[model samples]
Target chain A: MTTNILLITLVVLAIIALNTQKLRRAVVYLGVFSLISSFLYLLYGAPDVAIAEAVIGTTITTVLYLVALKKYQVFTIYFCSDPNDPNRRNLTNNSPFINNLESFLIKQEMEPQIIYSEKPLKTILTQDKFDLAICQTNQKTLIYGSVDDYQLDALEDYLLTNHGDLNIHLIRYTEGDDNEA
Target chain B: MTDNSEIITRMTGLLYPFILLFGFYIIINGHASPGGGFQGGAVLAAVFITRYLVDPNRCIQLKTLKTAEKILFVCIILYPTFFLFSTSASHTELMNLIYLIAMNFLIGLKVCSGFTIIFFRFVFYEGGIL
Candidate 1:
């Protein structure tokens, strides 16, 4: 009777782990699954295998999944250029600086989503959520980023050193500040 | 990762020595008792895992662990083969017991190091250091 219960619990945990949308929650479920299976192993008289399963399955696998999740984090950068600025026409087409930035973000293991917006910078900054926003004018490129983003520091250094010829202004947005630059 | 609560930290600190002693006891008496090398090694690994959970920023070098794992692997493989080839038909029980004990100790070391290495790698990579 107890064995049957454990088997049913194991099946349920496995299904939940597979079906869960969040990877972290799935990992936790898998941990519980492993723990139950290891107990089952002990009941079945395979203590050696049970020990290995309990150790490798519960602890090691969960940590590995979390690390993998961390390493593959995608950084979304929103590109919102002024639609009325006639001088900024063809800015999205064949822009070398934008291409370079995209490549740099890719190299850093981040997926840069460049959104070409006709909306004003104020609306994009205030209404829309984004990790970064790039506004292009005739004279300069305005890069808006969150102060809390750790990757922005490295990106700032990269932009200053590599694209020194371009007139670029970096504006940081902190919490509770809604001032339009 | 966040540090464990002060109560958990204090409790783990208080209980760590007992756990270590129990794990060693299991390893040493593996041939005669229910627990063996893998079980003991796993228990020992849990101690390290508990420590890491309390303090995520603690530095653990993986190179030494990898080296120790490799050494244990060699011992586990070679010693069993050597014993198998060299032992005669007489006094096989005594030889078997010794073999089991030696293999248990080696396996305990290997499992301990292997799990610890995986843990340290996960922590380091998660911290964006690797």
Candidate 2:
């Protein structure tokens, strides 16, 4: 009877974990599942297996999952390009820089969401908050990022080292300036 | 990641020694008790994990861990084989117990290092610290 209860609880936890939209909540549910499963293992008279299960399942796996989730956080990048620019027409679907940037973000384990905007740079900057904003003019590319973002420093360094040939300028917006503008 | 609460740091410092003692006890008395190599190693790994939680940016010496794991793994394989081949007749109970204890210790070391390596890799590389 006790085993049956534990098994049913495990099933319920698994289902709830699967159904949860939030990844963190799902991790928590999985932790609960592991805990119950460990208890079940103990009930089955395999104390050694139960100990292993309890340790690996409840602690190590949960921490690993949490770290992975943190690593693969969504990185929102907004691209605002001037429609009238002649370079815009040439850069329509095949922008090598954008592709490279996306690949770089992926390499860093970030899920990059690139939003192409027909609106002006100032309007996009002042309106919606973003991790990064790229403004493409005829001659140069302006990369606007918040000074508070720790990743921006790495991104800037990467741009300077890897894409030195490209006319890319990195602009950092301070916390005070962000609210005023 | 470097910055953590004072309470966490204090609690970890207070509990770490006891945890290590318990893990060692589990590993040493594994044959006579419910716990064994994997369980004890997992418990040992929890100590590192707790330290990581207190300070996520803690630098782990992977080279040392890898070397230790390799040595333990080699011992786990070679020791049993040596004992099996060297013994002409059936082994005594004392010999068997010694063999089991030694194997358990090696396994515990291997598992502990392996898990610690995994944790460090995940934190350093996948955690986007670089």
Candidate 3:
């Protein structure tokens, strides 16, 4: 009876974990589900698999979460045209930030036109629409087309939070350099 | 993190060993029924894991895991190899059982050590086997 309850609980929690959009919550619930499943495996007398599930499902996953979390502080944002102010919610942090907003907009589904630039020494930001021009560098200035300001701001904030983009050369990937503004 | 019920927490702490034994029992009786070495060993490891959870610093003893793992690996391989060479007809029931146990033990050791090593190397990174 208790075993059945465990199974049912695991199944429900697993469903919730899979469907949840929150990354941290998903990881936490997934860890619990894995640990419970390991318990069930013990009840059913499958030790080898139980061990693997326990380690991989629980410990490794928790580690993955911690490591990834250390790398980022995820923020949500979306792109839309609003010329007056592109980068909204300027997170008051002095650290350099990597702008992921433009790329988010130009994701595989967006099919953005990539433009290039001629000047190579320094880098700057310009905009076509309400989308913010996230200046990225990797030994060269990369202008990844136009991204919605909302998305760009979130990306920059994330970079700032992680303390990245200092003393690192920014590299840009887009269509061509002619559109450098 | 103690739970709501002091009795339950105390009981669980006390009963953890038995829970481990239960797993071990399943393992030892694996061949007789539907289980084998891997199952049994995992149960043993579970004891350590449980201990660790209950007291993070106290889960697996690094020295014990290393020494036992080395000895277990040697035995699993040596037993199987000896059987393969010496026994003209290892297809016999006794031989089959022995071989199964050996293989099961090896599987358990590998799984436990491998997971621990990976976790220690990539995740923990401070202590454990460097």
- Model 2, B69-118: lDDT tens digits are 99888888899899999996899999999999988888988999999998
Name the best candidate (by TM-score): 2
The CAPRI-style docking tier of model 2 reads: acceptable
Candidate that would win on lDDT: 2
Q: What's the candidate order when arranged by decreasing TM-score?
A: 2, 1, 3
For candidate 3, lDDT tens digit of each residue in A1-181?
A: 9899998998899899888856677889989999999899989988667766775578656655654443333221212212333342342122123234335434412223223223321342332321223333333223233332224344444445554434322223342223111
Best by DockQ: 2
Taking every candidate in turn, the Cα RMSD to the unseen true structure, in Å, is 10.4, 10.5, 12.8
lDDT of 3 by residue, B1-130 (tens): 2223556457669988786677566665666665455545554555544443354444345566667667777776687777778967547877687777657657666556644554444434542221
TM-score of each: 0.61, 0.68, 0.44
> Comparing candidate 1 with candidate 3, which one achieves the higher TM-score?
1
- For model 3, the DockQ equals 0.12
What lDDT score belongs to each candidate, Candidate 1 first? 0.79, 0.84, 0.52
Model 2, position A99, has a per-residue lDDT of 88
**What is the alpha-carbon lDDT for the whole of candidate 1?**
0.79
Q: Worst ten-residue run, lDDT, model 1 chain A?
A: A172-181
Which rank order by DockQ, best down to worst?
2, 1, 3
